[model samples]
Target: MTAPFDDLRDESQQLDSLVAALTPEQWAAPTPAPRWTVAHQIAHLAWTDRAALLAMGDPEAFAAEVAKALAAPESFVDDGADEGAAQEPAALLARWRDGREELQEALRAAAASKAKFPWYGPPMSAASMATGRLMETWAHGEDVAEALGVERPPTGRLRHVARIGVRARDFAFAAHGLPAPDAEFRVELVGPGGELWAYGSEGAGQRVTGPALDFCLLVTQRAHRDDLAVRADGPDADRWLDIAQAFAGPPGRGRPPKGPRPGPAA
Candidate 1:
């Protein structure tokens, strides 16, 4: 079994590499996400990583705390108080880097001591937390890559993304106010490191297959599945292609340009 620390370390290194090469002007460039500058995207990431660190430190207690925090108005000034309010993007970036380091430390410490972490909903093992971070960083990294007009570098971290894609099916069903699909589907990906990331049978149908990174990008709505080389077989699989939500919170309507979805695979 691969260690959680390895995943977390790789993600941090990837993030650092990206940040290091960015010009100050590039940092301020507008991304595909409407009205969100690259700076804004990173700020959101920094905030999220910090939040994850806090939650990991106190999983059980933080579960209730997260509920209350979510209830409160989301404002740096209000939620983080004066010190956080004063920090600008550069400061936020510095703090974000720090948070990454802190999370690595937390993961290492947790592994040695057997610490548990709180997640958005369910309890997360320290290993899961690392995967969750890997998933988030890579997805968000796509946005950054888009802003810079660069193709994303491939990585083995995609396994985490595949898992998130499967989980998003639940979000998709819930968003449309429909009961969960009656069948499960297997998901396979063809990428730098092709693998059977996930397989479902019976309940939600069977078999979802394609490029690993493409599958992840498409499901997260970062890229259209049609735009990528991903292919999904089975009934529910086609339906899943219509909508997939990975992140938590309320469902996003996603991009405009409504048009006919491609017909089912032959």
Candidate 2:
């Protein structure tokens, strides 16, 4: 299996390619994410990359950063993006690039360690952190691509995102202040390569089934569940689709259905 660190590097580079050639005006163009422009998307990713670095390399500093976030849960993320977005486009891009590289190295160096690191939620290993980073890059890159009126075809890396989404069923419920269903829910996703990726037991009573891309999009909150092909067989399963979120943090204010508008190109 390819390392999650490698997958993260590939995903980050893909997002970087989309922005590397963008003009300053293009960088300032608004994305599908409300009040956040293309620059803001990239800046947010860059800021997060830096945070991940701190979490892995300097636990004390990361805890201080966490305190800041707790003090301003609603605005802290926006504040980071806004601060980074204030920089010149070139400089912001450089910071993102450098930050991701540093994070990549941190993950790589700790790949053999079983130690868990602090995070907004529970602690995670190096590989889990890398997977989370990949998911974030892909989700934010979706925003940047839509802003540029371009499409990024789903890649095999989406498997990583799908896996996280499937595993986050409980987190989804908890994020909404609801308890998770006691019974496991079966998830069967059709990957970009047309292979089946299954989670939970085959005999599970509740189930979610769909194209992997749509599932990832729905889980990431990049697309509304109503707009996706995902299906749920039970009441709890149906609710999971509504509340699914792959990334950690507070419950997201998910995107509404695009209502008659064409989505990103194929």
lDDT of 2 by residue, 1-266 (tens): 24798899999999889999999999999998889999999999999989988888899999999999989989999999999999999999999999999888888888888989999887999999999989999999999999999988999999889999988889989989999999998899999999998999999998999999999999999998878899999999998888889888899999998777677999
TM-score of each: 0.80, 0.96
Off by over 4 Å in 2: 260-266
Total backbone collisions, model 1: 10
Count the clashes in each prediction.
10, 0
Please write out the lDDT profile of model 1 over residues 1-266, one tens digit for every residue: 34667876787677667766676788778877766666666666666777787787665666665777567624431344234424565776787788888877877677655556666655677777777777777777888777888876788777776777787687677876867776666776775755455556544446677778778777667776567777767666677777776766555546554356689999
- After superposition, the stretches of candidate 1 with alpha carbons farther than 4 Å from their true spots are 59-65, 68-89, 112-116, 194-198, 201-205, 256-266
**Cα lDDT, all candidates:** 0.69, 0.92
Top lDDT hit: 2
Global Cα lDDT for candidate 1:
0.69
